[model samples]
Structure formats: structure tokens, C-alpha cells
Target: MSNSLRLVIGEGLEHLEAHRAGAFAGDPEAIHQARVALRRLRSALKLFRRHLNPSARDGFNDALRALGRTLGAARDWDVFVLETVPAVMAVIPDQAEALGALVAPAQHERELGHVAVRALLEAPQTDAMLQDLGSWSGDRVAFSPRKAARQLIADEAGPLLDRLAKSVSKRATGLEEQDDEERHGLRKALKSLRYGIEMLESLHGRGNTKPYRQALSVLQEDLGRLNDAIAAVELVHRLPDQPGRLVIEAWANERRQEALIELPAAWHQFKAIPAFW
Candidate 1:
């Protein structure tokens, strides 16, 4: 196996171990880090599929995706309750009455999220999935030719780009509906796209994919800010009435609106860029 593949597999297993040990300790940052490792492993496999069995890689990818989604929900809820709510309160001090209305519902949502995360962790499939990954890592794999690698990358890049386009479209739809959860899902999609782009850059030079990279970066930043704002709003809604809540809420609202306006333009720029694939 190539050094990149070996590194990714090792890193993935390490994180999986931590996850299995409940290292997150119900902490959002820990959960996010574990999810990120899973993502990196998935992206690595996608980028280097030419060096492995397609069927085996696909199965591993599917498992990682499932785990990532579960962890993502838990992390999002954690951020909303612990980080975002307070920030929102700071921005909208005058809206204390409205913010108070959100506390019970946010707490209820967080409880549900906690249950889901625990269930996912305890699922039997998780063990089997990790074993499969272990098996793959232990096996010695041969590398494909450069030509084959290029072709595989090109093939995968098309589908990846399509996935990103669909995600952006979904986010647009969610924004129109004012569905916070759906918008957060879109942020997750943007993250996947950004990570994919980073992996691709490892194969293709930065110069070759500069426009795509730049556009993707802009989208990632915009979506990241929006996610933070959304989390802030949820957080402030959960906090007891406080003097600083109004200021935070106002700031979050302003940031959210700015991010919303910038997202489409960044997305359009991303769409216009020629795919290196």
C-alpha cells in the first residue's frame, strides 16, 4: 500500500479506538475530531481506490459515512446547546422574551440527539465495520499505474462534484423553508466537499485546481459561519435570561444574514469553475 493509504488507515483506527472507548465523554469537540478522522479515512479511500478492491472500499466508505452522520448530529446538537445559544443571546439582547421560548424545545432536541448517538455507538454493526477496516489495513495491497490512478480520480471526481452540487441545492431549498436542521445538513455537505477537494489537491497540483479550490474555500467559510450562527441562536434560546444574551443574538443574526447572502455567489463561482476531472 502507498504511504498515504497506510497513514490514513492508521489514523482512522486510532480515532475509532478512541470513539469506541467513549473518549468523547459527551464532549462536542471530541466527537467532531473523531468524525473528522472518519471523514479523512473515507476521503483517502476514494482518492486511492485504484490501489484497492472496489467492492471492499465501497463497503468501508458506506460504514464510515453512516458513522459520520450519527456523530455529526450529536456534535451539532452539542454546539447548539453549549456554544451557539450563548452567542445568539449576546447578539439579540432585546429578544430575551423570544429566546426564553426556545429553551425547553432545545433541551428536548438535545436529549433525543444524545439517545441517537448512544444507540449508534452501541450498534453491533459498528464492531463488524471496524473489523472490516482492520482486515483491510492488515492486507498488503498493490498500487495501480499512474494512468489508472488518473482515470479513477477523474471518474470519482465527477460524482463527488455532483454530490456537492446537490448538497448546495438542498441548502438553498432549506434556506427558503427556514429549516435550521436542513441548513445544518447542508453545512455538513459543504464540509465533505471541502475535504474531498483537499484530498484531490494531494493528487492534482494546486495550480491545476486553483479556481475550484478557491471557490470551495469560500463556500466552506460561508457555511461554517452560518452553522456557528445557527448554533448560537439555538444556544441563546436555551440559556436563562441574562443581560448579554441580547447583544449575542443580534450579532448572530447579522452574521447569519451576511453568510446567507454570500453563499449563493460563492456557490455560483464554484459551479463556474472547470472541474480538473
Candidate 2:
């Protein structure tokens, strides 16, 4: 388990570092990948919480979470300017010019957002945090020498995956009727469970986990699109109130409704899958 933890954390760190230059260059996919690496690292920490030192775990969790928020802000704008705006333009062709004009300032905001991401990436504090995480994952005293830490992952992976799966199931109990916050809660749970499965995939094999992962990917896509719509609402409000703003909001609302209608069926399909572990 301890060795596996080290491997997982190391992989996350490597994944995160791989995208730094691309994020600095304002590549949306790079920014998204970096954010995902952070999420996977945090999820790994939580997944292995029982075997970790509390103080070390909490500090790293807090720091990583702060970093995630910084990246997330930039990501939201990238989606809005790059994806959502283009999508709206395609769907509402007559309003394209007006919508483009309304979103011009949003493009500037996205530039500033990338600048902020660059600054954080270059910050000394971030370097220090990453160094500390590497040290911890390398067994350099950040993690306590607990019995649980020494246990074999082969004996532990199954129950951990099972617990994570059950958590997701519990969160999805009333999928279609869930409020935005509740649905967001489910999304987080699903992400954690998915990450858990991903981390342990080597043990379970791609053959065994592939179908389950595919199911998770589908459900997450729906949930993610819904989240984007909700975020678009909040983001559009930040723009100057204008006629096009109402159009964008309506478009986002329509997207939200579509996702809501499909969510229950997706949730059921996901629930029908047996726990892979």
C-alpha cells in the first residue's frame, strides 16, 4: 500500500509538471490536464487517508485544493470563451455577431486568467508545495510509520474500491431530482470513485475495469456538461447586462434541462454495472 501510494502520487506529480509549459502557453487541454492531475493527487490522498499522517495529509490537501481553485478559475473561462461561446454561436446563428461582441471582454478575461495560472505556476510557494509532496511520497518522513501503511495493496484495493463505489451509489440515489448542489455533490463523488478505480487499474487489469471506466466516462460527460451550463449562468452574470446576456443564459438553461432529462437514465445505467473490484 505504501509503495502504491508513492507510485500514485509520483505519477500525479509527473502528470502535473508535464502540462505546466502548455498551460503557460494558454492551451486549454493543458490547463485541463493540469487540473485533472491535481484532482487525482488529492483523490489519492483521500483514498489512502487511513494510512497517512493527518497533519501532512491535511496541509497537502489544503494546498492542492487552493491550487485547484486557481486552475479551475482559468479553466472555467477557457470553456466559456473557447467552447460555450462557439457552441452558442453555432446554435443561434442570427445572434452570432451580438454574442461575439458580448463575449469579447470574456476573451480578455481568459487571457488574464491564463496569466494568473502562469504566475501561480511560477510562484515559489507552489514549487515548495510540490517539493514537499514529492518528499512525502518518497517516504521521507511526511507519512507516519503506521501498520496500515505497510499493508499489501492486493489485500486492500478491493475494499477501498468497494467503499468508493458505494459512496457514488449513495450520492446518486435521487439523480434526476437533485438540485444543482446535490448533483454537483454526486459529480464529486463519482470523480473520486473513478479516480480510485483508475489508480488501482494495474491490479485489476484493463480488461476487468474497462467497461466500468467507460460507463463512468459517459456519466461524467453528462454531469460535466450540466456543470458547464450552470457555470455559464454564473459567468454570464459577470458580463455587462445586455440582450445577448439573456440569450446566452437561456441557451445555458436549455442545456441544463437537456442534461437533467438524460441524467436519470445515465445514472441507472451506471448503477446497473457490477462493482469491478
Candidate 3:
């Protein structure tokens, strides 16, 4: 468990460094990846809370989540400009100028988001949080015994994966026509499950996890695309009235419907796939 925890926390910090480099370079994917690693780290912490100080576990996870949100806002805009906008333009070329206008605001938002992330990273609280996490991962802080650490996979990790899967399957029973909130919940659950598996990847050989992770990624991407459409519509709603807003909404709606149509099959496939943990 200590090794697993160390692996997750170490990689998470490494990702934050990558995010810092990317932020300086203004690379969108770096910000996105860092946020993702933060999320995975938090999920890993939650799964192993029994081995950690209860107070420390929640506090560290909360701090990382707040950081993730900062990067997430920037990533959201990146998705809008790089993905949603392009998709919209392809379907509604006449709205190019309007879409360009949308990009301007999104770019501004992403810039502000980067500034926010940088500020958070520079804050004393953020430094303390990372330092504490480093202590745990680096063996300066002890959370569990050597025996416990080694047996975490066979004793604890597998069961957590099974329980999370069951929960998601129950939540997704009527997913296709489900409201926005339900699909959103499904996405969150799936990510938790994915991260849980990822944290244990070192325990399981890649031969088992590789295909499972790839398959899991397909559903994650589909859910992400669906959520992007939903979010794009919401973002457009917040903008000032313009000729392009309606067209963008129309395209988003079409995309949203298409995603909804595809999601159930993906969900079914996900359910059919065996757990690798």
C-alpha cells in the first residue's frame, strides 16, 4: 500500500511539474494532464483512506481537487476552442465569424484560468500541501505497515474496484434518456473507477491492464465529448446575444443527441468488460 500510495503521489507531483512547464509554454494538454493526474491521485488516496490519517487524507485530497478545478476551467475552454468550435464550424460554416468571437472570450477565460492556477501553485498553502504529500510518498511520513503495503492489492484493491463497478452499473441502468445530471454522475464514477485501476497498474502486468485501460478510455472519451456538448451549450448561454449563438447551440444540440445515442452502447460494453483489478 505504501508503494502504491507513493507511486500515485509521486507521479501526481511530477505531473504538476509538467503542468507548470506547460503553463509557462501555454500548452493546453499539459494543464489537462496535470489536472487529470491530480484527480487520479485524489481517487487513489480515497481508496486507501484506511491506511492514512483521516484528517490528512481528506485535506490533501481537497487541496488537490481545488487545484484540479483551477486547471479544469482552462482545459474546458481549450476543449471548446480546439474541439467544440471546430466541430461547430464544420457543421455550420456560415457561423465562422461568430465562432471566432466565441474563441476570443474562451481564450481570455483560459488565460485567466492559467493565472489562477499559477497563483494557487505559488500560494503557501499549496506549498505546504505538496510538501506534506512528499513527506508521505518519500518515507518521511508513515501511514501503514510494510505487510499492509504489500498486501493492499490482493486484500483491498480488488474489492474496491468491484464495489465501484457495481455502483456505476446501478447508476447507469437507464442512462440513455437520463437527465444531464445522471450522465454527469456516470462520468464521475467512471473516472474514479479508471483511476483506481490505474493506481494498481504496477501490481498488475500491462498485458492485463493495457487493453482494459484502452477500453475504459473509449467510454471516458465518449462521456467527455457528451459533456463537452452540454457544457458548450451552457457556455454559449452565458455569452452576449449574437448571430452565432443560435447556430452554435443548434450544432451542440445535434452533437449532444449523437453522443446520447452512442453512450448506451458504450455503457453496455463497459459493463460487459471484465475487471482487471
Candidate 4:
């Protein structure tokens, strides 16, 4: 087997093992990391599909996708509470009283996260899928490098780009809504675009995809900041009416509006890149 193939499989197995151990211990971070590893492994498999048996590859892909979805919601909520919410609260001290309201919800999300992690850890499907991945990874296969690269671009990268383009366009259309949920969806779309571009760059040469990838990176960053501001505002909104809460809300709103204005031009520039779609 090529070094590239071996490296991919080894990394994947490591991630799977880590995830399994973490989930068994009920570690939220481990569960999230495991999902990320599965995603990376799935991407690698797609990129190198030509070297794998079709039946086995399909099975691995399906299993990963299912597991990813099962864990994704819990991870999203965890991130919101543990990372985004706390960070926002820290920045807006005046809104501290209002921010307290979110603690309950955040704690609730944490409980759900634990439950989701436990369920996935205990699932028989997890063991079967990991075993299948191990067996497939150990199998020797031959493929023409050039042919495999071309197939990867055609089958995986092309479709991913199409999906990313559609997602961005859809998100852009809804930007005018200017609500926490709408902006959150936009952030998710930007993340998808960013990851898709990164995956393509890994398969294709970075030189060929740099402009588009950089554009995506910029868009993702700007949108992410904007989403953060929106979430901050929502946090304040949830607080009991108070003088300090109003001040925080106003600050957050100002920041959000500025980001909104900055985003359109950045988005236009990104869309203008020839390979962005």
C-alpha cells in the first residue's frame, strides 16, 4: 500500500479508538472529536475511493454519515452553551444578569449531549462499523494514481462544490431576516462551504484552488463573527429587562449591523472567484 493510503487509514483508526474510549467515559469533548475524526476518515475514503472495493467503501461512508448526524446535533448544542454562550457572556458584563437566564438551557443541552454520547457509545452499530473500517483498511489494493485523482475530483470534489454553492446561495437569500436562528443557519452554510473547499484543496493541488479556498476562508470567518454577535444579542434578549441588559443589547446590535454591512461585499468578492462554485 502507498504511504498516503496507510497514513489515512492509521489516522482514521486512531480517531475511532479515541472516540470510542471517550464516549465510553462520557466525555463530551471526546464525542465531538470522534465525530470530527469520522468526518476526516470519511473524506479520505471518498478521496481515495478508487483503491477500495465499492461495496466496502459505500458501507463505510454510510455508517460514518449516519454516526456523524447522530452526534452532530448534540455537539452543536454543546458548542453553543460551553463555548459560544460563555464567551458572549464574558464580553458583555453589563448583561450578566440577563445572561444568567441561559444557564438553565445550557445545562439542559449538556445533559442531552451526555445522553447522545452514551447512546452512540452503547450502539452495536458503532462496533460493527469500526470493525468494517479496520478490515477494509487492512486490505491491499492497487490503483493508478492519476486515474484515482481524476476520479476523486470528478465524483467527490465536483459534487461537494455544487452542494456548497447551493448552500451559500440559500443562506445569502435569508440574510435579510437578521435573527439568531437565521444567522446560525447561515453560519452553518458557511462552515459547509469552508470544509468543502478545504477537502477539494487537499485532493486537487492547493495552487489550483488557493483563490477559491481563501475566499471561502474569509467568508467563513466573517460570517462566524457575525453569528457570534447575533447569538450575543439573543443572550441579552433572553435576560430580564434591566438597564445593563439594554446597554449590552445595543452594543451587540451595533456590532451585528456592522458585520452585516461588511459581509455583503466580502460575499460578492467570494462569489466572484471563478472556482468558488
Candidate with top TM-score is 2
Runs in model 2 with CA error above 4 Å? none
Highest lDDT scorer: 2
> What TM-score, over all chains together, does every model reach?
0.63, 0.95, 0.89, 0.61
Descending-TM-score candidate ranking? 2, 3, 1, 4
Number of clashes recorded per candidate:
21, 0, 1, 0
Ranking by lDDT: 2, 3, 1, 4
lDDT of 1 by residue, 1-277 (tens): 3444555577667866776546235656667777787887886675566567777788888989988888877777777667665555565556656655665666777677767767877788887787778667556543444554434454555665566657666665635455667767777676666666665555554546677778878877887898788667666655676644565577778988998888778767776887665
Model 2, 1-277: lDDT tens digits are: 7678888999999999999899878899999999999999999998888778899999999999999998999999999998888899999999888788777889888888898999999999999999889888768365568776777877888888888888888888766667999999999999999888888875455556667777888899999989999999898888887777888899999999999888887887877778766
TM accuracy, model 1: 0.63
Candidate 3 Cα outliers beyond 4 Å, as residue runs: 138-150
lDDT of 4 at 146: 51
Model 1 steric clash total: 21
| Candidate RMSDs in order | 6.2, 1.5, 2.5, 6.0
What would the per-residue lDDT of candidate 4 be over residues 176-267, giving only the tens digit for each residue? 66666776777766665655555555445556667877877887777777766666565545545655556556666777778888887787
- Please give me the total number of clashing residue pairs in predicted model 2: 0
| Local distance difference test values of all predictions, in order | 0.68, 0.87, 0.76, 0.67
After the best TM-score superposition of candidate 4, give how far the Cα of residue 73 lies from its true spot, in angstroms.
2.7
